[model samples]
Target: MRADNSQHIVEAARRRSEYTRSKAVQALRALDAAGEPVTFETVAKQAGVSRSWLYAQPDLRAEIEQLRAVQRRAPRSSVPARQRASDASLRRRLETANERIQRLTDENRQLRAHLAGALGEQRAARSHTSPRGAASMHEGVDIADPVQPQQPIREREQ
Candidate 1:
């Protein structure tokens, strides 16, 4: 009786093992149909089997490894291609911007120098003129005014 009971238990265990293996195959098929990568983890999860069980199946293990390798390599090879294009475009834009900034800086310096020279000439003209005649070229507009040096508001406040 004990022998018969042990035999029955062994048969039940075998059936469960087969069921698990069948589920693993179904999982791989579902993944293929959905265009999903058949990695060990995904197959294990979908089949409700342990990773160890998937690895134990030599054919399935080999197939999963191949797919995983392809998935890994495909992305890495394409990334460098994309990065090269973007990097070159960015480098060109940066150089153009720097050149424009340099040109603007030079123009700004020239304008500042011209303004300083004009201001100096205006002061010299005012100093050379007598107080009675110390009026702007637009003398008709200064009927009730006098020519004088302007001081900053900060100095007046002080």
Candidate 2:
């Protein structure tokens, strides 16, 4: 009697498997009709099967995945091939900008050198015209006076 009961259980399981297989095929047809991407989750949901169970069927999984790959390769208007070419053109613009920067840097250095030479000449002329030991002519302050030169030091010493 136990053997008969076990055989009945096995037969019921087999029937359930066949039903699931038919359902999976129907789900794949539905996905194709809808023009939607095929995925394991979508297939499982449509077939009323668990995701783990669908994935365990390797042949069905491979067929659905190949369909998805074909969909991925189809062209879309949003990302055409010319955008990559534009990026290459942008690189050329960057090179031109770098050249301009280098030119400006050289001009700045030349201007700075000319300014330093002019300033040095002005300082030399001022020193030459001013009296010996006198403050700079441009400043207009008395740094030294011949009459009072030694008096301040002598008073401080005393």
Candidate 3:
């Protein structure tokens, strides 16, 4: 139009694109160095750019993909390999737990048997001490004696 500043505008746009690309690269490196996951969204956020823009750059896209692939292949656990528990150790722990459970089960069975015997003895003693006509609280009838028929009542002669 008046001064033909299209060339200047193009140069400015090229510089801005280069600046944005540099920021993205720096962000990617920072993330990698910090052991943080490198992805388009993270880089975009770190660099204050759009994910679409990062994808549009072939070099940046390739780098991000490569890093992501590496991360996927790497173990996700926080524990170091050397510090992790071995199979033998885990097996031993399981065996110990099973043994303890078995011991507890046996103890509980013994305790229940002892309690049943004590209660039976107590009930028998109570039945022997109670009056002949009195009913036992447990069975609603005397355990020591069998049921007896009552004699018929006869009217007295006047």
Number of clashes recorded per candidate: 0, 0, 0
Compared to the true structure, candidate 3 yields what TM-score?
0.47
RMSD of each: 13.5, 16.2, 12.5
Write down the worst ten-residue block by lDDT for model 2: 75-84
| Best of the two (1, 3) by TM-score | 3
**In model 2, which regions exceed 4 Å deviation?**
1-3, 75-158
* lDDT per residue as tens, model 2, 1-158: 33458888999999999999999978977776666667788898899998898778988888777766655775332332223246668899999999999999999999999999987897688668855545443353445565665334346459
Candidate 1 vs candidate 3: the lDDT winner is 3
Candidate number with greatest lDDT? 3
- Considering TM-score, which of the candidate structures 2 and 3 is the better prediction for this target? 3
Q: Regarding TM-score, does 1 or 2 come out ahead?
A: 2
- Each candidate: what lDDT? 0.73, 0.73, 0.80
TM-score of candidate 2 versus the correct structure, residues matched by position: 0.44
Residue clash pairs of candidate 2: none
Q: What's the C-alpha lDDT at position 73 in model 2?
A: 74
Residue pairs in collision within model 3: none
The global Cα lDDT (0 to 1) of model 2 is 0.73
Off by over 4 Å in 1: 1-3, 73-158
Model 1 clash pairs are: none
Off by over 4 Å in 3: 76-158
